[model samples]
Target: MDIRQLARGTVPWDRLERVATILARRYDRDAVRVEFLAADNWLSIPCIVDDEWFVKIVTKQHTRVHALLTAGRNAGALSSGSGGFFTRFETPLAMVEHEYEATQRMREIGCNAPEPIEAFEANGLGVLVLEYLPAFESVDDLDATRVRALAPELFATLATMHDNGLAHGDLRAENLLVADGDLYFIDATKVLPDRQAAARAYDLACALAILEPRVGVRSAVAAASEQYAAEDLLDARDFLDFVRLRPDHRFDSTRLRSELEKWAALSEG
Candidate 1:
C-alpha cells in the first residue's frame, strides 16, 4: 500500500483498512484499529493492534526530526511537554526526528528516557513508535525530593550525552516525563552538538537555578544535588544558582527569575 497515497487529507475508514493491511504485510503484524492521538509538535495518529503494540503514525516532518536528533546535535528548543501541541517552529519533521533519536541515545547510555521502537515516514507523514510508559502523572505532582532524585539522573544522562556529543538546550520540567516510576527526558529539538564544556555548565546551571525554587533543599533534593555535583558535571556557581532559583510552591516565574539573578551575581563574584 502506498502509505503516502493513503495518507492524504482525512483517511477514510476504507483507506485505513488498506493502510493497516499494508502495514501488516510490510511489518508482519496484525492491527486492530487506528485512531487519532495528540498533535503536540507533530501530527499523531495512534494505530492499535493486538495487546502487544500500538503504531503511532507521525507526520514526515516529525520523522526527520527524530533521525537528526539521535545523532547528538542541536535541532532547536521544544515548547511542548508530554501533553499537546505547544510550540511552532520550522522543520517540524527534523526537530521531531532528532528529539526521538536523542532520547534513544540517552536510554542507551543508561540514562532515563523513553524507549524508541521505530521511526519512519511515508506519504508526508512521519512516525515514531515507542515503548509506552504508564506511571508518570504531570510536572506539578513532583516535590523537592523527587526533583532532587531526578536532577542527578538527568544530569548524569545529559553528561553522558554530552560526552557522546549531544545537547538538549531546553531543559525544563515539562519536557521530562515519568514513565514506569522513573524520570525520562522527552523533547529533543533543542539538543546541541559537540558538547561544549562551558555551554553544558551554563545549561545545567540554568536548569538548576530554575528548579531550585520549586524543589528547594528538601533532604532529597539536597542529597541528589550533592551527588550530581560530585560528578563534576556541574559547576559550583550553576548548582548554587539552581538552589537560588528553586521556585515558590505557588509557581511564580518572575520571583524565580529575580532570585536567579541574585545567585548569578554571587556566581560571577
Candidate 2:
C-alpha cells in the first residue's frame, strides 16, 4: 500500500454514513449521493455530494498529519532566515474551519475561489462543504503553452492576495484549478497573522518553482516580474532552496536563482 494511504488513514463506513445523513438533513434533502474522490490528498477525504457540494471529511489522523506537516513547513521557513509562519490546528474541526475561512477571505479580497458553504463537525469528524466545480482541470494537467499563457495571471492573483495581507501558506500546481478558462485557488493553509510577509515570499517561491520546469526559469521569473518587483523576486529567491525540499515541487533552483539575479541586475541597470 502507498505511504500516503497509510498516512491519510481511513474513515470507517459507518461514520461516513453518519456524515452523509447529517449533510442530507442540513441541506433538506431526502437523500444525497456521495462520490468519494480518489485524490492524492494527505489531510482530508474529499467527496462530492449530490454533484453540488465539495466536501472534505477530516479525521483525527488527518489533524495529526497536518500538525506534522505544519512543523516541517515551519522548519523550512526557519532555514530561509525567517521565523516559522505556518500555523497548526489542534483538532479536526479547526483544520476545516481554517480552510473555510481562508477560502472566504480569498474570495472577499477579489480572488477567485469556490463558494464556501459551511464547516461543521459530525460524528466526531470535521466536514467542510463548498460549491463544487463540475468541470475543471488542475494547473498540473495543462500543457506548457497553456501554462505559459496563464503564468502572469497566476502571479497577479498571488500579488492580490499578498497586497491584502493574505497568504496561501501552501501553493502547488494541484492546488490551482482552471474552470471555464478562469483560475481558481483552493486548499489555502493557515499562517500566523504577523508572519504574512515571510509567507508571501514563500508563496512566490512556490509559484516560481511550479512554473520553472514547465515554462523555464527565465520565463517563470519574467512572468513573476509582471506582478512583483525585482526586490520581491530576490526576497522570493531566499526561499527557493526551501521550496525545493518539498516532495511536491521539483525545479532547477540554481538556474532559477541565476535568472532572478540577472533579472534584478537588469532592473537596476
Candidate 3:
C-alpha cells in the first residue's frame, strides 16, 4: 500500500456529474437530489434517492493526526494521543479491499454486513460502493427491554464470525444498523485476523458498556455474561464476579479478561 499515493480533492466536476447521471438513470428524478455534503479537505456528495438509498462519494484527505485520534478512540484503542501519533499505515485501496474481503467472509458465515458492490480506484484514489442500509436504525433508538432482547442474538452472531476466524476493529452501536429486526454492520475498514476469544470478549464488553446506560446495570451485565457463557467464551461464575467489579459494575477490559480466563479454564476442564 503506497501511503503517499492517496487521492485528494473533488475539484473534478465530472465525478459529481457522473454520480448524478447514474442516480437519475436508476431512480425517479423527484426522489433524487445531489448535495455537496462536505467540501473541505475531503469531499462527499450524497445522491439521496428518496429515503431508500444514498450514494456517497467519499474522497480522502492526507491522514491527519486529529482524524486518526478520533478514529482510534472510536475503535477503543489507547486513549492517550499525547504519547504518540498515527501514520498512514494503509492505503485507501488496501483498506477498501480489506473491507470487501471481510464483508464477503461475514456473509459466508451468516453474519449480517452491508453488501459490497464495487470498489473503484482512479488516479491513486479509491471509493467503495456498499448496499445502502436505508431501513436500518441505530440501537440507540431502542429501549432497555429491546436492547436486552437483542444482545444475546447480536453476540451470538459476532461469536460465529470470530469462531470462524474474523475480527471487527470497531464494534459499536453506531456502526451497527437494525433493519427489519436484523442487525447489519456497516463500517468494515479495519477487520483483523482471528483472535476468537479476545475479539468476542472485547465486542461483548463494548456492547454491554453501551447497553448498561440505557438498561439497568444489572440487566446489561447479565445479558453480556449470558452470551459470553453461551458461546463458551467465558465461565458464568468468573464472569459474574468480574461484572461485579466492572468500572460501572458493567463492562471493562479488566473484567473481560477475567471472564475470558475463566472460560479458558472451563474449556481446559
Candidate topping lDDT: 2
Q: What tens digits encode model 2's per-residue C-alpha lDDT throughout 1-269?
A: 88888888988899999999999999899999999988788899999999999999999999999999999999988988999999888988998999999999999999999999999999789999999999999999999999999998899999999999899989999999999999999999999999888999999999999999999988999999999998999999999999999999999999999999999999988
Alpha-carbon TM-score of each model against the true structure: 0.58, 0.98, 0.64
RMSD of each: 8.7, 1.0, 7.7
Q: What lDDT score goes with residue 222 in model 2?
A: 95
**TM-score of predicted structure 2:** 0.98
Per-residue lDDT tens digits of candidate 1, residues 165-214? 66565556666777666767765544233334544554554455545566
lDDT score for candidate 3 against the true structure? 0.53
Model 2 alpha-carbon miss at residue 19, Å: 0.5
Worst 10 residues of 2 by lDDT: 2-11
Better of 1 and 3 by TM-score: 3
Model 2: colliding residue pairs? none
lDDT of each: 0.50, 0.94, 0.53
Off by over 4 Å in 1: 1-22, 38-56, 60-96, 143-145, 190-206, 217-269
Winner by lDDT between candidate 3 and candidate 2: 2
- lDDT at 197, model 2: 88
- Candidate 3 lDDT at 264 equals 52
lDDT (C-alpha) at residue 229 in model 3: 54
Between 2 and 3, whose TM-score is larger? 2
